[model samples]
Target: MALPDRYTGDDFYCDVAIPSAAQLDVVHDDELVLAYHHTRPFWATHLVVVPKRHIDSFTSVTECDEADVRQLFAVVQRLAREVTEREGAAAVLTNLGRYQDSKHLHVHVHSGPQRDHT
Candidate 1:
């Protein structure tokens, strides 16, 4: 039989750091939280926001998880504002299936210089 949609696996959670690997100041955190920017980023400013909980994916969100979801979005909005203030603009995104790398549910917040088509 196929594995259940919400199977708790080893790759569920992760430790997110800012500057990709370089130790920097922590902007925000909670009991289970990791938020930071990428050292080598696609955008001028790229940050990864994830819950300490090992959630499978967005599709796995349950009715009981409504509060968690709300909290996640709230954080995202707050972070977006911060990024906009710092970078002048921001974008939020999440991946699914093959696009997902950590296996844990996460949202990517990006902002910075706009790419120029040469």
Candidate 2:
């Protein structure tokens, strides 16, 4: 999956990805957030759960309201549980600072073997 140069360099989630999520394989969609399969998955069962609005990263979550944060986690929790049950195990994660590719508060719910990115 060849990503656009802008996707690698900028907040593609806020600028394009999230808005165009309809094209992705969505798992959950609500007023609070959107959960979908990763376009370029690093894990076999990778899914991304993100707040409907941007918040930069996990460390910058204070910018969002408590309810927004709660809702996002609630969704993440459910997805994690589902993945764990179906796949025998699951991992939930969020990156920060330089590790965060997308400048948006998002959680990843994934299971199974990790995939080779290169």
TM-score of each: 0.69, 0.89
Clashing pairs in 2: none
Clashes of each: 0, 0
TM-score, predicted candidate 2 vs. hidden true structure:
0.89
Candidate that scores best on lDDT? 2
Q: Model 1: clashing residue pairs?
A: none
Model 1 lDDT tens row, 1-118 = 2223353443533443422223633445665556666434567777776665666778888887676677777788899999889778889999998887667777878986744435
Q: What value does the lDDT take at residue 26 in candidate 2?
A: 91
Q: All predictions: root-mean-square deviation over Cα?
A: 8.4, 2.6
Residue runs of model 2 more than 4 Å from their true location after superposition: 1-6
Candidate 1 has its poorest 10 consecutive residues by lDDT at 12-21
Name the Cα RMSD for model 1. 8.4
How does model 1 score by TM-score?
A: 0.69
